[model samples]
Target chain A: MRERSDDTLETPITSMIDIVFLLIIFFVVTAQVDKDVVDESITLAQAKNAPAIDAVDPRSVTINLNKDGKINVALQPMSISQLQQLLLAMRTQAGSAIPVLIRCDYETQFRHIDRVMQAAASTGLYRVRLIAEATGG
Target chain B: MRRKPPEQLNVPMSSMIDIVFLLLIYFIVTAREEVTEAHLAVNLPAPGVAKASENKPQMMEIEVHPGYLSVRGMRLPIQEIANTLVRLGKNDPDITVLVKVNLSARAEDLVTALDLCSAANLNNLNVVTLK
Candidate 1:
């Protein structure tokens, strides 16, 4: 009778390591995309009933409104007109279905958010989303 | 004669695989899928555009004050606003809810009002800035 070789007992792990590396790379890439569009400095409001968006449109614009009513898009601070222009440009490219996500500090006055919404409305991009903390924080 | 183990098997990948799995778990936990952030969707009226419907819907306006919320000039606390909105929504789910947010009112106040509106399943919501 032929003896079983020890080499045959070793599991083929090379493919598993490859798969793990791919998964890690995928997660790393997706985790990073939000950093550029979402400003970490702004503290979002807390809400109990807002629906969670499962898939955010790629063409969606994220606007950060600070307590002082300043507007930041992609981390670059801009005036309301500048925001209008950006929305117009996006509207031209994305054809008016462009979703606008607003992230504002809890203490930020409503006027700031209103201005952002008005800017979006004027640009014919009326799909506005107000971002809030889901945990009621 | 006993066969010797191959020298090529000296570098075991089990330890490396363990570290890779740890990294994968870290990334999985840290990945911000934006699920932590809830969203309230609003469809704003396009500028210079009028509603096509001939019938004007009954609009319920809620003003966000610094300390409390107001419905049709009646003052109510933030916690109590939800009950009023829920009652209105019960009457008509399509009732237009106009949130008139005071310029000095904190964003949290407006959010709370909208939260209540959403909770009531009020679909027609319009946010207008107070003059």
Candidate 2:
């Protein structure tokens, strides 16, 4: 009977280490963290033929709505009156008409959005825009 | 100390370069280079028809409620709304009109308001839902 050799051969560790490092770098650089920050709970309505709006300036203000029908600016809850005042102040400071964008959740009530629109209108901010996700169909 | 043989010490530079290039390309392709602009936080209503052409700029927003239709907050009748929008369009040829309807608002009321806008020659109309 022939005896088998008992050499315990181990795999080279540096190559595995290098591959793991590359993967970490790839995710760190490529992951889209900003888009994820924009709340995904809101399922924007589909437009059969909505034009793509690219290169939106940062001067625009964003309002976020939750399912419970609450309005928040940059994640802070605000009343219609407060939003109106804030917009007015922004207009004054910017010296140019600042565009207003509303980001409401799909489950939000219609009246809640109406109030916000009314508030913008009363404040003389007429350049109001609504944001929705694009649909394939 | 005795040095190791050249073959044993050799590391494949070409393979390492290829891997590095692949990693660079992957990151460059996946990164979000452009800053995403923030939009209005409203859940718009889905439209039955295709969106109108973007030949004109949106100038007015008409909101429909259960009992009344308001243009910029002032309650007005369907005919009055048409007249008002026509006047506004005449003043600004590049006028875009947005009609936001409440979910509970009657379909007839919404259709009437839309008809008024269309009759006024406001072709650039968009229907949206309130958040």
Candidate 3:
């Protein structure tokens, strides 16, 4: 018969601590902290060579154009005038050099987008970017 | 002096704790999530090396709907579309072509319009969707 010895029993505290540290490192490395302001209902064109954009800057504003030709800012529908007003307010908040990013659907009209651009230009917003997919991966 | 066994030696956990804390801080500082912005869904071809120039006003506009193709709202035939693009390209090498296609427009229709633009060697093409 084999005799069990209490002296041989060892608490796995050190191993448990090591496992906790590993978990922390794993989460730290794999966590996705950046999330898009706009919803996925808006399908953006895929460009294999699109320039890498900086998302940490709070000065960038995203405007979405739906398939129905409706304009929405962060999922809230707004008129051109309203959009202009909101953009102007954002410009003021961002202190003069605000970057406006417009993401429109593939079926949106030029005139509609042009009007939005015109509004941004008139508001004295200089950094206007028309987002497009870079071709040919 | 008597020597102790190697397995009985204690590891200095303080240093390891400091490392863990430093790692935690480093992750906290650099762990910002990537923000994805809205965009159009299209495959753009790789652009060859060309001299950059100031953007100019758009001269030619091509509209693509489900069954018809129009140039500046004027309905035109497929053969004429390519011809017009070639003529316009010859007139102004810096010409800006605005391509507006409806959402429900067929992929073939969009491709045909793009093909016409390609045949004309028009590089400054701006594609917009008709909402």
Candidate 4:
């Protein structure tokens, strides 16, 4: 009878090692976090019930409102009319299912945020999220 | 002649595989799918959502100014907001606070006032637009 080779019992690790390396690369690529639009000088208002978003909707627009009531998108300051136009465009492009996240500075007047909300509402963007800092327990 | 005794082969990948698995576990434990971005989600008063009714919601007006917050014509400091709202909310649970702020007022002041309404458990609110 032919003798069995010693290598017959050994399991190969090359495939699993390659898979793990690929997984590490995938995570590293996806973990690059973009800086949020809120300015460092501005303080965030406290809220008792504010919570981190749950199951972030893929179709979401984040607009930043500074203390000056200026709305900034991707670091470019925009007028209220411009913002309205943008919201109207987004609403038409993505449909009403998209949720809008407004990150207004804590010191920003409510009117600015309200104007944005009104614009969003006018464009049929009713679903909204107002970003704020969590208050102390 | 008797065949030479088989030589012992060292497994080169055992330790490397163990290290890779440890790293995999570490990444799996540390990775978060969603970042912690705090927010308050609300649905605006949609035309379809608001039905025509004679019994409209009781509305309360609160004007946000640069130096003070005016609730029902009484101007007060920002700190006095919660107490007043709690009292008003107690008087009428269904009171909807409508906030009208000057363009110059800071967002912090507005939110601080709004926080009062939230503290008083007043869910129906409208932060009126400037324009």
Query: Between 3 and 4, whose TM-score is larger?
Result: 4
**What tens digits encode model 4's per-residue C-alpha lDDT throughout A67-124?**
7777887677888889889888988898888778887777776657778888888988
Chain B TM (all candidates): 0.70, 0.52, 0.55, 0.55
DockQ of 4: 0.45
**Fraction of native A-B contacts kept, per candidate:** 0.84, 0.12, 0.04, 0.68
Measured against the true structure, the TM-scores of the candidates, in listed sequence, are: 0.76, 0.48, 0.45, 0.66
Clashing pairs in 1: none
iRMSD computed for candidate 3 = 10.9
Residue-level lDDT tens digits of model 2 in B90-126: 7875576777787766433444555555446565666
Tell me the whole-model lDDT of each prediction, alpha carbons only.
Answer: 0.79, 0.61, 0.62, 0.68
Per-residue C-alpha lDDT of model 3 across residues B23-126, encoded as one tens digit per residue: 87886886554334322222211233111211335467789887789977889998898888889888886686767777667433554565567557676665
Worst lDDT 10-window in candidate 1 chain B: B46-55
Between candidates 1 and 3, which one is better according to lDDT?
1
What's model 2's lDDT at A119?
Answer: 72
Candidate 1 share of real interface contacts: 0.84
lDDT of 3 by residue, A44-129 (tens): 44333233353525766877766566788877789989988998898778765566777765555545555666667667663455
True interface contacts retained by model 4: 0.68
**TM accuracy, model 2:** 0.48
